[model samples]
Target: MLSFVNTTYLGFENIARKSVYTSLSKDLALKADEQNLTTLAKNAKFSKDEESSFKNTIHFTDFVSNTKISLKISDENLSNLKAKFAGNISLQEDGSYILKKEAESIASGWFADIAYKRGYLKADANNDGKLSDEERKNIYSYYGNGGFYSTSGGNVATVMATEAYSYLRAEEDFRDFTSKSLEEEFNKTLEKDSDFNGEILYGEMMSKGQMIAQAQSYIQNEGYTPPTFLEDMMDQFDQLNKKMLKDLKKLLEEKRLEQEALEKAKKELEKTAEIDIKHSNDQSLDKNLEKIENLKSQNPESQSFKQSLNLKEFSQAYMQSFKVDLKKELILETLKKQNDINYPLDMSKTKIDLKI
Candidate 1:
């Protein structure tokens, strides 16, 4: 009876040890899963309150079975068994395994974060988390021109289609998708399509024909049918492109007309300035001629006065016509050499034109 009791006690001890090891392995697995989920929530930009709520609600103790099971296994065997179950177990997207609203938020956040980081989405310049009309237009322009993959040596339409396909597929697989992994797959596809180096050369970049070919190749390879949202986005981008081109053409025409108007105004101002200058010069010449005639009438027979009168008439006829200046010294010399003594003329206030 002593021998049998001892044997039974040993068997119980083995079973208890195995049970403890199994429980410990399960606890470790749950802890790892919790860490991964917390990391995902953090990446999705969860608030501290949200994180706390998530930890309280989504933890293994809250959602999974905790009933201990009987087992008889060695320590080495237990370690092997734990390793076998160490593979990643992802949450489902259908809300069967997780809160539907919370899961959707996380997925949306992840997509937003990826799109922003990869330059496919624009941020609010005012930091208000909302797009203004102008910002919306800019987004349309960006997409019309091909978004982040714009420089990937593909046509705008083809690049846009590729990006749309990749995004939709990733969205569909959001539960298991990560930004890093998605980015890697995108790059791989783009490199294969375009034969990318660090940068694509201008000549090696896709032409419209090449783009069409590559796009067709992509569709065949991925067996992807673009969703309605993607199709709508593509249509919107095309419309935006057409509108932009039309606006650009109209702007160019407006600029051209403005430039022509400015040129015409300048010419008119120059012509008016020339007329005013000529009128002022004509008035000055008329006053000088009147002074000369009065001097000639006062001393009609004086040779010097006659010579001065003749010189004045000659200057008005030739020098004034040619826009030349009359010499003041010559005029003064002619006046000083007057033959008459009865009348003397003061030449002090006489003005001579000096500019041609």
Candidate 2:
């Protein structure tokens, strides 16, 4: 229960913070026009939501703070982008280390061009094909003086891919379409699955950006976002697990009651097996010695067992052998009690004349 509360708290906290970042970003985005924002989009990088957050927090902050604005893509370019960078990609299990190694190789040449364009390499006097320690210091100092450039280095290509991938991965596949159109597109994309129709019965539709914002908002983790497709699978899995867990708990509780009933019945009848292993010190009489043992193990200090009365006095002397347990005894006592269960024994305590 505490865990659930913590998780819920964290989720809402994220929404609040994203409301900060997003609300702030909107004001920041308004400072630039659409054309410039679109151009910034070319160079801007968001560590794909699927990327490991170990280092991406820094990347995300940079993208959010320095990238200046967000822009909506034109439908024509969006189509061409969909053709090139399909939304169906998944992360490699090893955080794509192999792919990163190759990507770094490709990105190795990006800094010189990027730095040159931003005038850092152009300030390279005595041109030794690289920035000296003194030159590097000058570059850092000039960062606030309109020498806008990223220190993203080799991650540029992957960040670009991440942006493209996230852009096209809508809330649901063809989710923006009307319900009638969604049904058509879903059926068209259908392979062999019978239940693959586009009608999701559970949740309202939200786009990739909304999901990312939600993930950032509601999820307590920094720089984590679940894509639309993953959320679809997760929602189904959670529902199934929840139902299965509830059913299993109910079955367990029923089984527990049955076991408790059996124990009490066996104790009432003195039919339980002896502690054959306590051969030298087996001192129990008719096994009623431990009649309260099972209940004691569950609650050793319970007041129910505070009154010690010999079962032999009650069961062996006055009652005939029957399948009834303590529960049945209580019921019959309720039916026959003048005041209560044999509080002070008399002829009135005899419940049935069982000559039958």
Candidate 3:
């Protein structure tokens, strides 16, 4: 029984250890996920002025920027020329293409330009200093007649078309060179095989045909990816929402401070207004005292039994003896026109020797 109990206890211990380990692993994984989300949030946040080009039209790859795309054509395309007509390629019955001429000219232009390495080398057609008139005519005849001095137009076309086939590789002369580039990136692996002297060719590629090629190469015809993750979209949205709440709180705090400042200013203005009012009231009191002094100067003791009192004390004494208005001028006017007042004979005046 003790052995049985020991075995049961060991089993429970193993289960508890496994459970603990399982819980720890889950907790660790969850913590890692949360931490990763935080990092992603930080990186995902864009600046206010950082404009999004998501899905905005942008050129991903340009052929002029990456020209040869691999080429042996220093061509063959020109050798088939009939001189004056820089014509477009034509399609044939055998699913083939050839260059066609627009017009004919006297000289085999290719002989002067392309029969050899073309930088400074030439057949000395016209610029021969030692040649006389007759020799010059002979040189023009030999080069211009287009016999053994030159190749036929179709042969040049075939070589050029073959070269094109080598690179373009499509029968109708094209494969899709554009894609939704911003979704990923242009396949840069293809650029590893390209060969073009971009720096030197910039000034040289000024032809109208080159302009057309450039327009085709750099265009706004692709899709792009916006700032959103399909998988972690919900988490990102939640984080953004939380950020908005934080911003709202910040705005609330700012407005609260502004309101408090306005209230403080209003209180200060009220205090200033109260002080101005008090000063105005004090000025009015001084003016009234001045008026009283003027009245005293105007009135003199003429009667032998005339009574006299200070203005302040007279005002107090008159108030105690009567239930009259507060204006001193009105009380004095009433006293001056005593005939206008008809009162009881016993209550005519106070015993302070005729309170006026």
Residue 107 lDDT, candidate 3, scale 0-100: 15
Report the lDDT tens digits of candidate 2 across residue range 202-269. 01233334543343332233232323434565579999999999999999999999999966865444
Candidate number achieving the greatest lDDT relative to the actual structure:
1
For model 1, how does the per-residue alpha-carbon lDDT over 90-154 read when each residue is reduced to its tens digit?
24453222223332222223232233322223323443323344433323111101111121122
Residue runs of model 1 more than 4 Å from their true location after superposition: 1-225, 307-356
Itemize residue pairs with steric clashes in candidate 1: none
In model 3, residue pairs whose N, Cα or C atoms come closer than 3 Å (at least 3 residues apart or on different chains), thus clashing, are none
Which candidate do you rate higher for lDDT, 1 or 2?
A: 1
Q: Which pairs of residues clash in candidate 2, taking residues 3 or more apart in a chain or in different chains? A: 11-218, 14-217, 15-217
Candidate 1 vs. true structure, TM-score:
0.29
Candidate 3 per-residue lDDT, tens place, 1-356, comes to 00111111111122211110000111122243454333332232221222322221111111111111111111222233212234544434753334333211111121111111120111223332122333222221110000011112212110000000011111221112211111111111112112211111211213334432322232212111111322255478899999999999999999999999976875565455445544544555455455545555767553321333666665754444443223533433444465354323243432334412
Worst 10 residues of 1 by lDDT: 1-10
Name the candidate, 1 or 3, with the larger TM-score value: 1
Count of backbone collisions within predicted model 2:
3
Give the distance in Å from residue 197's predicted Cα in candidate 1 to where it truly belongs.
13
Error of 3 at 179 (Å): 43
Cα-based RMSD of candidate 1 = 26.4
